[model samples]
Target: MEEKAKSFEELKPMLRPTGVEPGIMKVDPEKCTSCGLCIQNCPFKCLEMDEDEHPKMKSGCVCISCSNCIVACPVDALSIERVYTVKGGFFDTETPAVKMPMPPKDADGTPAEWNEVERVVLERRSVRHYKKKPVPEPLLTRVLEAGRFAPSGGNHQPWKFTVVTDPEFIAELEATLHGFWSGVYPVFNNDETVMNMVGVVETGVFDPRTQYGIRCIALKELPVYLGAPVIVYMGAHTKLNNPALTIGICGQNMNIVANSLGLGACWTNFGAVPLNAMPELKQRLGFGEEWTVVTALVLGYPKFKQFGMVARHYRPVTWFRPGTKTPQTEK
Candidate 1:
């Protein structure tokens, strides 16, 4: 087997981080076109043309890992690398050296502080398998209201929402998704969970006692989008630089609001891609052609209380500390 050499130019595009930064750039000499395309498309203007008219680091620290330049490059020629060994591990791809913007401030324009909100974030969990009951219209409205309040870039507010309340619509949507996924099982057989599902689906032998999991656990077991009786579909204008981010913020807002209201919510993206491909479904959902589905949520009341808080294990607190292995005393 040939060991793959780093085609930094070709592979660099994939390394650009969607967010988070002040990272590294790895370039491949062999695949570099020197067309300066990377420099042209960079959102932060962090890339520049060298004497050879090839893309090179400009300020180096202006990158935010948006990956725009990497994706825009005609020939993949850039990869983000971390200057420090410790910072590289957090990013899925190399991010250009740049700082993430600070979170927004509160209504009084003071830098936002949300101790309660932070607490809610820690408490949130994915809840599936809800008891059969219709979600009330008022509660669904509140969840959507919270989502609409989410901030957007330049306050574009370019989002549309479709709340699937009718059981028939939900059933139809789920059935369509089920068929599509069932067809694609062969291609994804390498995935163990998917492979097992493929085996079951292929058998075509119906066994009522055998529990066949649906696309999303929330979609399968719950009566109303997992028991809250509502599902919210969030769509965004893809022309924006960060549609996904915008939609995600909105989704979180809805989730938090739902939690506060004593409702449970689970986020899912399984429907977005395929749902967009079907024009009829998109139109029925009232989303426009310029709009792309960002995310969806299954919402309902919890059948049982969440398991209480446990120790939060994460990458490491040492990275944020002054030095490695600094002994901690709870402040």
Candidate 2:
């Protein structure tokens, strides 16, 4: 009986959705590139590429609103928004004029110049390997506190944050992340290899592999994650309006806060992929049935290397319609 009970416990579900609403992450199919970036970054595995070659939310309890999809989108097209509502509201609502606060005007009654935010966005690098040093607790607390104050829809304030500093837990999470990479490697970028009579077949179709794969290699090769010594896991309210947007705002806020504190941080959805695949991992991290993983940012000191922004390569900007001054037919 004891052994049977233990087996059942091992097989038990780690979480269950409240069903008050069918939780989902809405992906704009028209803007989708089938890049799989969102799918790879989603901590809850709530997103997967569909037959239409668009992202689809596959799990009811998988959305954690880490906002990785929004940042990873090559085109400023993808956004993370709520899938369901506990209380039905207007589906098509305009921005309420009443909610607007009139800024102090110029002497001519024109609005004043835009005020800059306290925080500035940094040129963030996707840091894979760390130096295996621990981040200071006070600094980590300050980062979380910055997230705690992020804006929400109608002040829903439904976000939850859990920080894991335990080395064993971090190691376990890393193992799960590696497991995810091992499984998804073949699917991403067409890396499937078939074995024949030889020891093993080799397929190098996907060049450079994934950033995470490269990071795994760096962890072995160089002191990357640069011994920052800490990993911060962010969890957000999955049911809020534009949950992805809110989480993005909050996550960026945390990043800026960290930057201001003289600490370096890198945001990635690598940790989330495995957490989504295995529920027990979520439970172990202290998330109940109702919550989801939004994103994970590895924090640490840098290897004294400065990675600045690169020149942005982009398609030409096109306008919807040509000026009326010129006819449709061009010279």
RMSD of each: 20.8, 17.3
Model 2: ten consecutive residues of lowest lDDT: 91-100
Q: Which is the leading candidate under TM-score?
A: 1
Candidate 2 regions with alpha-carbon error over 4 angstroms: 1-124, 187-228, 307-309, 313-331
lDDT for residue 121 in candidate 1, whole number 0-100: 70
Angstrom error at residue 11, model 2 = 35
For model 2, residues 1-331, the per-residue Cα lDDT tens digits are 4543223233212111122343355677777778776665443345677888888877534343435455556654565355323232222122111111234577899877534332234245444334556677988999989988988788876667778777776666666566556554444323222112012212221212232343442343222222336777666656666666777788888887776676767776656534645778777776666666777776766543322232221323344465555434311
lDDT of 1 by residue, 1-331 (tens): 9866554343332222223334345667678888665554443355766676667766534444445455455556666664322233223333223332235588888887656766577556665545467778888888889989999889987678988877777777777766665565333333333333433343221111111222122233312233335678889887876788888888888999888887777775555556777888888898878889777898776655441222221232233466756665432
Candidate 1, superposed: residue stretches over 4 Å from native: 1-116, 190-228, 311-313, 317-331
TM-score, one value per model = 0.53, 0.50
